[model samples]
Target: MVYALTTRITLSTYESFFRIVRQILPLNYNQLTIITDYERGLMNAVRIVFPQTKLQGCWFHFCQSVIRYCKRSMNSLFQLFQTSVEAATVLRMVLALPHLPAESQINCNFTMLDGFQIIVDYVNQQPVIRERLQAFLFGYIQDFWFRQITAENISVFGLEFLKNDINRLLLYKL
Candidate 1:
Protein backbone atom coordinates (compact mmCIF):
# COMPACT_ATOMS: atom_id res chain seq x y z
CA MET A 1 0.00 0.00 0.00
CA VAL A 2 3.06 2.23 -0.15
CA TYR A 3 4.19 4.14 -3.24
CA ALA A 4 7.64 5.59 -3.80
CA LEU A 5 7.09 8.25 -6.42
CA THR A 6 9.74 10.43 -8.01
CA THR A 7 7.19 12.82 -9.52
CA ARG A 8 5.81 15.73 -7.52
CA ILE A 9 2.64 15.01 -5.58
CA THR A 10 -0.20 16.45 -7.62
CA LEU A 11 -3.79 15.71 -8.55
CA SER A 12 -2.79 13.97 -11.77
CA THR A 13 -0.12 11.90 -10.05
CA TYR A 14 -2.51 10.80 -7.30
CA GLU A 15 -5.26 10.11 -9.84
CA SER A 16 -2.96 7.87 -11.89
CA PHE A 17 -1.75 6.09 -8.74
CA PHE A 18 -5.30 5.55 -7.47
CA ARG A 19 -6.39 4.26 -10.85
CA ILE A 20 -3.63 1.65 -10.76
CA VAL A 21 -4.58 0.73 -7.18
CA ARG A 22 -8.20 0.27 -8.19
CA GLN A 23 -7.12 -1.99 -11.01
CA ILE A 24 -4.91 -4.10 -8.73
CA LEU A 25 -6.74 -4.39 -5.41
CA PRO A 26 -10.03 -6.20 -4.78
CA LEU A 27 -11.15 -3.53 -2.36
CA ASN A 28 -14.58 -2.91 -0.88
CA TYR A 29 -14.58 0.85 -1.36
CA ASN A 30 -17.82 1.29 0.59
CA GLN A 31 -16.27 -0.19 3.71
CA LEU A 32 -12.93 1.57 3.32
CA THR A 33 -11.99 4.56 5.45
CA ILE A 34 -8.75 6.24 4.47
CA ILE A 35 -7.08 8.33 7.18
CA THR A 36 -4.54 10.68 5.72
CA ASP A 37 -2.85 14.00 6.36
CA TYR A 38 -4.54 17.12 4.96
CA GLU A 39 -3.23 17.01 1.43
CA ARG A 40 -5.78 18.51 -0.93
CA GLY A 41 -4.46 16.81 -4.05
CA LEU A 42 -4.41 13.32 -2.56
CA MET A 43 -7.78 13.80 -0.84
CA ASN A 44 -9.40 15.09 -4.00
CA ALA A 45 -8.00 12.19 -5.99
CA VAL A 46 -9.29 9.68 -3.47
CA ARG A 47 -12.73 11.29 -3.59
CA ILE A 48 -12.69 11.17 -7.36
CA VAL A 49 -11.60 7.54 -7.54
CA PHE A 50 -13.48 6.09 -4.57
CA PRO A 51 -16.49 8.29 -4.05
CA GLN A 52 -18.13 5.74 -1.75
CA THR A 53 -15.17 5.49 0.64
CA LYS A 54 -14.93 7.51 3.85
CA LEU A 55 -12.02 9.97 4.09
CA GLN A 56 -10.66 11.29 7.39
CA GLY A 57 -7.76 13.59 8.11
CA CYS A 58 -5.28 12.39 10.75
CA TRP A 59 -5.97 14.16 14.10
CA PHE A 60 -2.27 14.48 14.89
CA HIS A 61 -1.62 16.08 11.52
CA PHE A 62 -4.57 18.40 11.99
CA CYS A 63 -3.25 19.57 15.37
CA GLN A 64 0.27 19.98 14.05
CA SER A 65 -0.93 21.96 11.05
CA VAL A 66 -3.05 24.24 13.22
CA ILE A 67 -0.22 24.88 15.66
CA ARG A 68 2.24 25.44 12.84
CA TYR A 69 -0.20 27.88 11.26
CA CYS A 70 -0.59 29.72 14.55
CA LYS A 71 3.17 29.95 14.92
CA ARG A 72 3.63 31.31 11.42
CA SER A 73 0.63 33.59 11.04
CA MET A 74 0.10 34.69 14.63
CA ASN A 75 3.38 34.46 16.47
CA SER A 76 2.26 36.66 19.41
CA LEU A 77 -0.71 34.40 20.00
CA PHE A 78 1.51 31.38 19.63
CA GLN A 79 3.88 32.85 22.19
CA LEU A 80 0.97 33.40 24.55
CA PHE A 81 -0.09 29.81 23.89
CA GLN A 82 3.33 28.64 25.07
CA THR A 83 3.73 30.97 28.07
CA SER A 84 0.23 31.45 29.50
CA VAL A 85 -1.66 28.58 31.07
CA GLU A 86 -5.06 30.09 30.12
CA ALA A 87 -3.97 30.60 26.54
CA ALA A 88 -2.62 27.05 26.43
CA THR A 89 -5.92 25.70 27.78
CA VAL A 90 -7.91 27.57 25.14
CA LEU A 91 -5.66 26.24 22.39
CA ARG A 92 -5.97 22.75 23.83
CA MET A 93 -9.76 23.08 23.76
CA VAL A 94 -9.58 24.15 20.14
CA LEU A 95 -7.41 21.11 19.42
CA ALA A 96 -9.86 18.86 21.29
CA LEU A 97 -12.71 19.98 19.02
CA PRO A 98 -12.22 16.91 16.86
CA HIS A 99 -13.28 14.80 19.86
CA LEU A 100 -16.63 16.60 20.18
CA PRO A 101 -19.80 14.68 19.33
CA ALA A 102 -20.27 15.30 15.63
CA GLU A 103 -24.02 14.69 15.65
CA SER A 104 -24.85 17.00 18.59
CA GLN A 105 -27.04 19.96 17.75
CA ILE A 106 -27.19 23.27 19.62
CA ASN A 107 -30.56 25.03 19.52
CA CYS A 108 -29.88 28.68 18.92
CA ASN A 109 -32.24 31.47 17.99
CA PHE A 110 -29.48 33.63 16.52
CA THR A 111 -28.56 33.00 12.90
CA MET A 112 -24.84 33.37 13.60
CA LEU A 113 -24.76 30.93 16.50
CA ASP A 114 -23.76 27.27 16.29
CA GLY A 115 -22.17 24.54 18.44
CA PHE A 116 -18.93 26.56 18.57
CA GLN A 117 -20.81 29.10 20.65
CA ILE A 118 -19.67 27.28 23.77
CA ILE A 119 -16.06 27.97 22.86
CA VAL A 120 -16.94 31.58 22.10
CA ASP A 121 -18.76 31.88 25.40
CA TYR A 122 -15.70 30.60 27.26
CA VAL A 123 -13.45 33.01 25.36
CA ASN A 124 -15.75 35.94 26.08
CA GLN A 125 -15.23 35.36 29.80
CA GLN A 126 -11.48 35.80 29.41
CA PRO A 127 -9.64 39.15 29.47
CA VAL A 128 -9.76 41.55 26.48
CA ILE A 129 -6.32 40.43 25.32
CA ARG A 130 -7.46 36.84 25.37
CA GLU A 131 -10.57 37.86 23.47
CA ARG A 132 -8.31 39.00 20.62
CA LEU A 133 -6.61 35.61 20.75
CA GLN A 134 -10.04 33.96 20.61
CA ALA A 135 -10.98 36.01 17.54
CA PHE A 136 -7.83 34.85 15.73
CA LEU A 137 -8.34 31.22 16.71
CA PHE A 138 -12.04 31.30 15.75
CA GLY A 139 -11.29 32.96 12.43
CA TYR A 140 -8.60 30.37 11.70
CA ILE A 141 -10.94 27.50 12.56
CA GLN A 142 -13.78 28.98 10.49
CA ASP A 143 -11.68 29.88 7.47
CA PHE A 144 -9.31 26.90 7.32
CA TRP A 145 -10.72 23.91 9.20
CA PHE A 146 -14.47 24.41 8.67
CA ARG A 147 -14.23 25.72 5.12
CA GLN A 148 -11.47 23.59 3.62
CA ILE A 149 -11.81 20.38 5.64
CA THR A 150 -15.28 19.42 6.86
CA ALA A 151 -16.19 19.04 10.54
CA GLU A 152 -17.25 15.43 9.97
CA ASN A 153 -13.84 14.51 8.58
CA ILE A 154 -12.06 16.27 11.46
CA SER A 155 -14.20 14.85 14.27
CA VAL A 156 -13.38 11.36 15.61
CA PHE A 157 -16.25 11.25 18.12
CA GLY A 158 -18.06 7.88 18.33
CA LEU A 159 -15.53 6.28 15.96
CA GLU A 160 -13.12 4.97 18.63
CA PHE A 161 -15.33 1.98 19.49
CA LEU A 162 -15.74 1.10 15.82
CA LYS A 163 -11.99 1.43 15.30
CA ASN A 164 -11.38 -0.88 18.26
CA ASP A 165 -13.83 -3.43 16.89
CA ILE A 166 -12.16 -3.29 13.49
CA ASN A 167 -8.76 -3.82 15.11
CA ARG A 168 -10.11 -6.86 16.98
CA LEU A 169 -11.59 -8.28 13.78
CA LEU A 170 -8.30 -7.77 11.94
CA LEU A 171 -6.39 -9.52 14.74
CA TYR A 172 -8.82 -12.43 14.68
CA LYS A 173 -8.54 -12.77 10.90
CA LEU A 174 -4.75 -12.61 11.07
Candidate 2:
Protein backbone atom coordinates (compact mmCIF):
# COMPACT_ATOMS: atom_id res chain seq x y z
CA MET A 1 0.00 0.00 0.00
CA VAL A 2 1.27 3.44 -0.99
CA TYR A 3 1.19 5.35 2.27
CA ALA A 4 1.93 8.76 0.84
CA LEU A 5 2.99 9.90 -2.58
CA THR A 6 5.47 12.77 -2.83
CA THR A 7 3.37 15.86 -2.20
CA ARG A 8 6.12 18.02 -3.76
CA ILE A 9 9.45 17.67 -5.47
CA THR A 10 12.17 17.96 -2.90
CA LEU A 11 15.12 16.16 -1.39
CA SER A 12 14.15 13.70 1.36
CA THR A 13 14.48 14.88 4.93
CA TYR A 14 14.44 12.67 8.01
CA GLU A 15 11.03 14.01 9.05
CA SER A 16 9.58 13.33 5.60
CA PHE A 17 10.93 9.78 5.62
CA PHE A 18 9.69 9.16 9.13
CA ARG A 19 6.19 10.33 8.22
CA ILE A 20 6.00 8.02 5.23
CA VAL A 21 7.30 5.03 7.18
CA ARG A 22 5.03 5.47 10.19
CA GLN A 23 1.98 5.44 7.93
CA ILE A 24 2.94 2.08 6.42
CA LEU A 25 1.67 -1.08 8.13
CA PRO A 26 3.87 -2.89 10.60
CA LEU A 27 6.76 -4.59 8.79
CA ASN A 28 8.30 -8.01 9.24
CA TYR A 29 11.80 -7.07 10.35
CA ASN A 30 13.10 -10.63 10.01
CA GLN A 31 12.69 -10.58 6.22
CA LEU A 32 13.23 -6.88 5.66
CA THR A 33 16.46 -6.32 3.79
CA ILE A 34 16.95 -2.73 2.77
CA ILE A 35 19.69 -2.12 0.22
CA THR A 36 20.56 1.51 -0.35
CA ASP A 37 23.46 3.75 -1.27
CA TYR A 38 25.50 5.47 1.44
CA GLU A 39 22.80 7.80 2.72
CA ARG A 40 23.28 8.28 6.42
CA GLY A 41 20.16 10.37 6.92
CA LEU A 42 17.84 7.77 5.47
CA MET A 43 19.71 4.95 7.17
CA ASN A 44 19.43 6.63 10.54
CA ALA A 45 15.71 7.09 10.08
CA VAL A 46 15.30 3.43 9.16
CA ARG A 47 17.28 2.29 12.18
CA ILE A 48 15.16 4.42 14.49
CA VAL A 49 11.88 3.45 12.86
CA PHE A 50 12.56 -0.24 12.18
CA PRO A 51 15.38 -1.35 14.39
CA GLN A 52 15.42 -5.03 13.43
CA THR A 53 15.55 -4.61 9.65
CA LYS A 54 18.71 -5.59 7.84
CA LEU A 55 19.99 -2.50 6.08
CA GLN A 56 23.11 -2.84 3.98
CA GLY A 57 24.36 -0.29 1.49
CA CYS A 58 24.87 -0.96 -2.18
CA TRP A 59 28.36 -2.41 -2.61
CA PHE A 60 28.73 -1.08 -6.16
CA HIS A 61 28.03 2.52 -5.21
CA PHE A 62 30.40 2.36 -2.27
CA CYS A 63 33.21 0.93 -4.36
CA GLN A 64 32.56 3.30 -7.28
CA SER A 65 32.67 6.27 -4.96
CA VAL A 66 35.98 5.05 -3.53
CA ILE A 67 37.33 4.35 -7.01
CA ARG A 68 36.47 7.85 -8.25
CA TYR A 69 38.11 9.45 -5.24
CA CYS A 70 41.26 7.38 -5.79
CA LYS A 71 41.35 8.17 -9.52
CA ARG A 72 41.45 11.92 -8.93
CA SER A 73 44.62 11.52 -6.85
CA MET A 74 46.14 8.43 -8.50
CA ASN A 75 48.62 10.20 -10.77
CA SER A 76 50.64 11.27 -7.76
CA LEU A 77 50.85 7.70 -6.46
CA PHE A 78 51.25 5.34 -9.42
CA GLN A 79 54.28 6.75 -11.23
CA LEU A 80 55.97 3.36 -11.09
CA PHE A 81 53.74 1.56 -13.61
CA GLN A 82 52.34 2.22 -17.08
CA THR A 83 48.95 3.92 -16.92
CA SER A 84 46.97 0.99 -18.37
CA VAL A 85 48.21 -1.70 -16.02
CA GLU A 86 48.23 0.70 -13.14
CA ALA A 87 44.62 1.76 -13.55
CA ALA A 88 43.51 -1.85 -13.98
CA THR A 89 45.39 -2.94 -10.88
CA VAL A 90 44.14 -0.03 -8.76
CA LEU A 91 40.53 -0.66 -9.73
CA ARG A 92 40.88 -4.41 -9.31
CA MET A 93 41.90 -3.98 -5.70
CA VAL A 94 39.11 -1.54 -4.95
CA LEU A 95 36.42 -3.51 -6.76
CA ALA A 96 37.48 -6.79 -5.21
CA LEU A 97 35.94 -5.85 -1.86
CA PRO A 98 32.30 -6.30 -2.91
CA HIS A 99 32.98 -9.75 -4.33
CA LEU A 100 34.42 -10.76 -0.97
CA PRO A 101 32.10 -11.99 1.76
CA ALA A 102 31.21 -9.89 4.76
CA GLU A 103 33.23 -12.23 7.06
CA SER A 104 36.00 -14.80 6.43
CA GLN A 105 36.88 -16.38 9.81
CA ILE A 106 35.13 -19.75 9.35
CA ASN A 107 36.81 -20.44 6.02
CA CYS A 108 40.50 -20.27 5.15
CA ASN A 109 42.10 -17.12 6.49
CA PHE A 110 42.76 -15.54 3.12
CA THR A 111 43.28 -12.20 4.83
CA MET A 112 43.75 -8.91 3.02
CA LEU A 113 47.05 -7.74 4.55
CA ASP A 114 48.74 -8.17 1.18
CA GLY A 115 46.13 -5.97 -0.45
CA PHE A 116 46.60 -3.47 2.36
CA GLN A 117 50.33 -3.41 1.72
CA ILE A 118 49.76 -2.84 -1.99
CA ILE A 119 47.50 0.10 -1.21
CA VAL A 120 49.86 1.54 1.38
CA ASP A 121 52.91 1.11 -0.85
CA TYR A 122 51.18 2.84 -3.75
CA VAL A 123 50.30 5.85 -1.64
CA ASN A 124 53.17 5.95 0.88
CA GLN A 125 55.78 7.43 -1.45
CA GLN A 126 53.54 10.26 -2.62
CA PRO A 127 52.90 13.03 -0.13
CA VAL A 128 49.63 14.27 -1.60
CA ILE A 129 48.14 10.79 -1.99
CA ARG A 130 49.30 9.72 1.44
CA GLU A 131 47.52 12.67 3.04
CA ARG A 132 44.32 12.33 1.02
CA LEU A 133 44.33 8.55 1.35
CA GLN A 134 44.47 8.76 5.14
CA ALA A 135 41.52 11.13 5.09
CA PHE A 136 39.36 9.52 2.39
CA LEU A 137 40.17 5.80 2.56
CA PHE A 138 41.42 5.04 6.05
CA GLY A 139 38.60 5.63 8.51
CA TYR A 140 35.65 3.80 6.96
CA ILE A 141 36.91 1.49 4.21
CA GLN A 142 39.99 0.34 6.09
CA ASP A 143 38.07 -0.63 9.22
CA PHE A 144 35.29 -2.26 7.21
CA TRP A 145 37.72 -4.41 5.19
CA PHE A 146 39.67 -5.44 8.25
CA ARG A 147 36.50 -6.59 10.00
CA GLN A 148 35.35 -8.59 6.98
CA ILE A 149 38.73 -10.20 6.25
CA THR A 150 39.58 -10.99 9.87
CA ALA A 151 40.50 -14.52 10.98
CA GLU A 152 36.99 -15.39 12.27
CA ASN A 153 34.65 -14.46 9.42
CA ILE A 154 33.52 -16.95 6.76
CA SER A 155 35.22 -16.45 3.37
CA VAL A 156 33.24 -16.22 0.13
CA PHE A 157 36.12 -14.64 -1.78
CA GLY A 158 37.49 -17.18 -4.26
CA LEU A 159 41.19 -17.37 -3.42
CA GLU A 160 42.31 -20.28 -5.59
CA PHE A 161 40.39 -19.13 -8.66
CA LEU A 162 41.67 -15.59 -8.32
CA LYS A 163 45.24 -16.82 -7.92
CA ASN A 164 44.98 -19.00 -11.04
CA ASP A 165 43.50 -16.16 -13.06
CA ILE A 166 46.17 -13.77 -11.88
CA ASN A 167 48.87 -16.27 -12.82
CA ARG A 168 47.42 -16.84 -16.30
CA LEU A 169 47.01 -13.13 -16.93
CA LEU A 170 50.53 -12.36 -15.79
CA LEU A 171 51.91 -15.15 -17.93
CA TYR A 172 50.12 -13.78 -20.98
CA LYS A 173 51.27 -10.24 -20.27
CA LEU A 174 54.87 -11.27 -19.68
Candidate 3:
Protein backbone atom coordinates (compact mmCIF):
# COMPACT_ATOMS: atom_id res chain seq x y z
CA MET A 1 0.00 0.00 0.00
CA VAL A 2 1.15 3.53 -0.72
CA TYR A 3 1.70 5.41 2.52
CA ALA A 4 3.29 8.78 1.77
CA LEU A 5 4.44 10.87 -1.15
CA THR A 6 6.77 13.84 -1.24
CA THR A 7 9.05 15.58 -3.71
CA ARG A 8 12.17 15.61 -1.57
CA ILE A 9 14.32 12.74 -2.88
CA THR A 10 17.40 12.09 -0.84
CA LEU A 11 18.70 9.45 1.51
CA SER A 12 16.92 11.15 4.39
CA THR A 13 13.78 11.46 2.31
CA TYR A 14 13.90 7.73 1.60
CA GLU A 15 14.37 6.97 5.27
CA SER A 16 11.10 8.78 5.86
CA PHE A 17 9.44 6.52 3.31
CA PHE A 18 10.44 3.50 5.38
CA ARG A 19 9.51 5.26 8.60
CA ILE A 20 6.00 6.15 7.44
CA VAL A 21 5.45 2.73 5.93
CA ARG A 22 6.44 0.95 9.15
CA GLN A 23 4.43 3.28 11.37
CA ILE A 24 1.36 2.56 9.24
CA LEU A 25 1.77 -1.17 8.81
CA PRO A 26 3.56 -2.25 12.02
CA LEU A 27 4.62 -5.41 10.29
CA ASN A 28 7.86 -7.36 10.59
CA TYR A 29 8.90 -7.70 6.98
CA ASN A 30 11.74 -10.08 7.53
CA GLN A 31 10.77 -11.36 4.12
CA LEU A 32 9.29 -8.94 1.60
CA THR A 33 9.61 -8.06 -2.04
CA ILE A 34 10.51 -4.46 -2.93
CA ILE A 35 10.36 -3.58 -6.62
CA THR A 36 11.99 -0.26 -7.40
CA ASP A 37 13.37 1.69 -10.31
CA TYR A 38 17.04 2.60 -10.68
CA GLU A 39 17.13 5.00 -7.78
CA ARG A 40 20.42 4.00 -6.23
CA GLY A 41 20.09 6.52 -3.40
CA LEU A 42 16.75 5.06 -2.33
CA MET A 43 18.04 1.57 -2.98
CA ASN A 44 21.00 2.00 -0.64
CA ALA A 45 18.83 3.66 1.97
CA VAL A 46 16.43 0.73 1.80
CA ARG A 47 19.30 -1.71 2.16
CA ILE A 48 20.52 0.18 5.19
CA VAL A 49 17.12 0.58 6.83
CA PHE A 50 15.49 -2.70 5.87
CA PRO A 51 18.02 -5.47 5.78
CA GLN A 52 15.51 -8.28 5.41
CA THR A 53 13.60 -7.05 2.36
CA LYS A 54 14.42 -8.60 -0.98
CA LEU A 55 14.91 -5.74 -3.41
CA GLN A 56 14.07 -6.47 -7.04
CA GLY A 57 14.84 -4.18 -9.94
CA CYS A 58 11.92 -3.14 -12.13
CA TRP A 59 12.03 -4.78 -15.56
CA PHE A 60 11.45 -1.54 -17.42
CA HIS A 61 13.98 0.34 -15.39
CA PHE A 62 16.30 -2.61 -15.63
CA CYS A 63 16.03 -2.44 -19.40
CA GLN A 64 16.89 1.23 -19.19
CA SER A 65 19.72 0.32 -16.91
CA VAL A 66 21.04 -2.11 -19.47
CA ILE A 67 21.31 0.81 -21.88
CA ARG A 68 22.85 2.99 -19.18
CA TYR A 69 25.23 0.28 -18.11
CA CYS A 70 26.13 -0.43 -21.69
CA LYS A 71 26.95 3.21 -22.25
CA ARG A 72 28.94 3.31 -19.05
CA SER A 73 30.52 -0.12 -19.39
CA MET A 74 31.60 0.03 -23.02
CA ASN A 75 34.42 -1.97 -24.47
CA SER A 76 35.00 -3.66 -27.84
CA LEU A 77 31.54 -5.26 -27.50
CA PHE A 78 29.44 -2.10 -27.56
CA GLN A 79 29.58 -1.46 -31.32
CA LEU A 80 28.08 -4.88 -32.01
CA PHE A 81 26.62 -6.72 -29.03
CA GLN A 82 25.41 -3.66 -27.09
CA THR A 83 22.90 -2.48 -29.64
CA SER A 84 19.26 -1.91 -28.64
CA VAL A 85 18.23 -5.22 -30.14
CA GLU A 86 20.76 -7.10 -28.01
CA ALA A 87 19.67 -5.12 -24.97
CA ALA A 88 16.08 -6.13 -25.69
CA THR A 89 17.15 -9.74 -25.43
CA VAL A 90 18.70 -9.06 -22.05
CA LEU A 91 15.59 -7.17 -20.99
CA ARG A 92 13.50 -10.12 -21.98
CA MET A 93 15.44 -12.29 -19.55
CA VAL A 94 14.96 -9.78 -16.77
CA LEU A 95 11.27 -9.50 -17.62
CA ALA A 96 11.01 -13.23 -17.13
CA LEU A 97 12.30 -12.90 -13.58
CA PRO A 98 9.00 -11.68 -12.10
CA HIS A 99 7.00 -14.47 -13.74
CA LEU A 100 9.04 -17.19 -12.07
CA PRO A 101 7.58 -18.74 -8.93
CA ALA A 102 9.29 -18.18 -5.62
CA GLU A 103 11.19 -21.46 -6.01
CA SER A 104 12.47 -20.40 -9.43
CA GLN A 105 13.43 -16.99 -8.11
CA ILE A 106 15.54 -18.67 -5.47
CA ASN A 107 17.17 -20.83 -8.10
CA CYS A 108 17.79 -17.77 -10.30
CA ASN A 109 19.32 -16.00 -7.32
CA PHE A 110 21.72 -18.91 -6.89
CA THR A 111 22.51 -18.82 -10.60
CA MET A 112 23.25 -15.11 -10.26
CA LEU A 113 25.62 -15.90 -7.42
CA ASP A 114 27.52 -18.25 -9.68
CA GLY A 115 27.77 -15.50 -12.32
CA PHE A 116 29.24 -12.98 -9.88
CA GLN A 117 32.69 -14.00 -10.91
CA ILE A 118 31.82 -12.44 -14.28
CA ILE A 119 30.92 -9.20 -12.45
CA VAL A 120 34.19 -9.31 -10.60
CA ASP A 121 36.01 -9.70 -13.87
CA TYR A 122 34.03 -6.88 -15.42
CA VAL A 123 34.80 -4.57 -12.52
CA ASN A 124 38.46 -5.42 -12.68
CA GLN A 125 38.52 -4.55 -16.35
CA GLN A 126 36.24 -1.50 -16.21
CA PRO A 127 37.22 0.73 -13.32
CA VAL A 128 35.25 3.70 -14.68
CA ILE A 129 31.85 2.30 -13.72
CA ARG A 130 33.15 1.55 -10.23
CA GLU A 131 34.38 5.13 -9.82
CA ARG A 132 31.20 6.57 -11.33
CA LEU A 133 28.80 4.64 -9.12
CA GLN A 134 31.12 5.44 -6.22
CA ALA A 135 31.16 1.72 -5.59
CA PHE A 136 27.45 1.65 -4.78
CA LEU A 137 26.22 -0.86 -7.39
CA PHE A 138 29.45 -2.78 -7.20
CA GLY A 139 29.20 -3.05 -3.43
CA TYR A 140 25.53 -3.91 -3.69
CA ILE A 141 26.27 -6.76 -6.06
CA GLN A 142 29.09 -8.04 -3.90
CA ASP A 143 27.53 -7.68 -0.46
CA PHE A 144 23.75 -7.89 -0.71
CA TRP A 145 22.50 -9.20 -4.07
CA PHE A 146 21.76 -12.91 -3.88
CA ARG A 147 23.93 -13.40 -0.79
CA GLN A 148 21.02 -14.89 1.12
CA ILE A 149 20.61 -17.45 -1.65
CA THR A 150 24.20 -18.46 -1.11
CA ALA A 151 24.24 -17.99 2.65
CA GLU A 152 26.08 -21.26 3.03
CA ASN A 153 28.90 -19.87 0.86
CA ILE A 154 28.94 -16.39 2.37
CA SER A 155 32.28 -17.08 3.98
CA VAL A 156 33.72 -17.65 0.51
CA PHE A 157 32.39 -14.23 -0.52
CA GLY A 158 33.98 -12.84 2.67
CA LEU A 159 31.23 -10.45 3.76
CA GLU A 160 31.70 -7.74 6.33
CA PHE A 161 30.15 -9.29 9.42
CA LEU A 162 30.50 -5.98 11.23
CA LYS A 163 28.50 -4.16 8.55
CA ASN A 164 25.73 -6.75 8.79
CA ASP A 165 25.51 -6.18 12.55
CA ILE A 166 25.19 -2.45 11.90
CA ASN A 167 22.44 -3.09 9.33
CA ARG A 168 20.43 -5.04 11.90
CA LEU A 169 20.69 -2.08 14.30
CA LEU A 170 19.56 0.31 11.56
CA LEU A 171 16.63 -2.00 10.82
CA TYR A 172 15.26 -1.79 14.36
CA LYS A 173 14.11 1.83 14.13
CA LEU A 174 12.63 1.41 10.66
Model 2 score (lDDT): 0.51
**What is candidate 1's lDDT per residue for 79-168, written digit by digit as tens?**
877777777777777777776655554742322124456667777777844555755656788767877787777776656534543454
Each model's C-alpha lDDT? 0.71, 0.51, 0.47
lDDT tens per residue, model 3, 33-141: 6656557677776777777886655444433444455445534223333344533333344323323333324335444433444445544555433343323334433
* Candidate 2 off by > 4 Å: 1-12, 71-84, 111-174
Q: Please rank every candidate by TM-score, starting with the best.
A: 1, 2, 3
The true-versus-predicted C-alpha distance at residue 119 of model 1, in Å, is 1.8
The pairs that clash in candidate 3 are none
Model 2, 14-60: lDDT tens digits are 54765566676566767776554455565666667666776565544
Total backbone clashes of candidate 1, pairs 3 or more residues apart or in separate chains: 0
2 or 3: which has the higher lDDT? 2
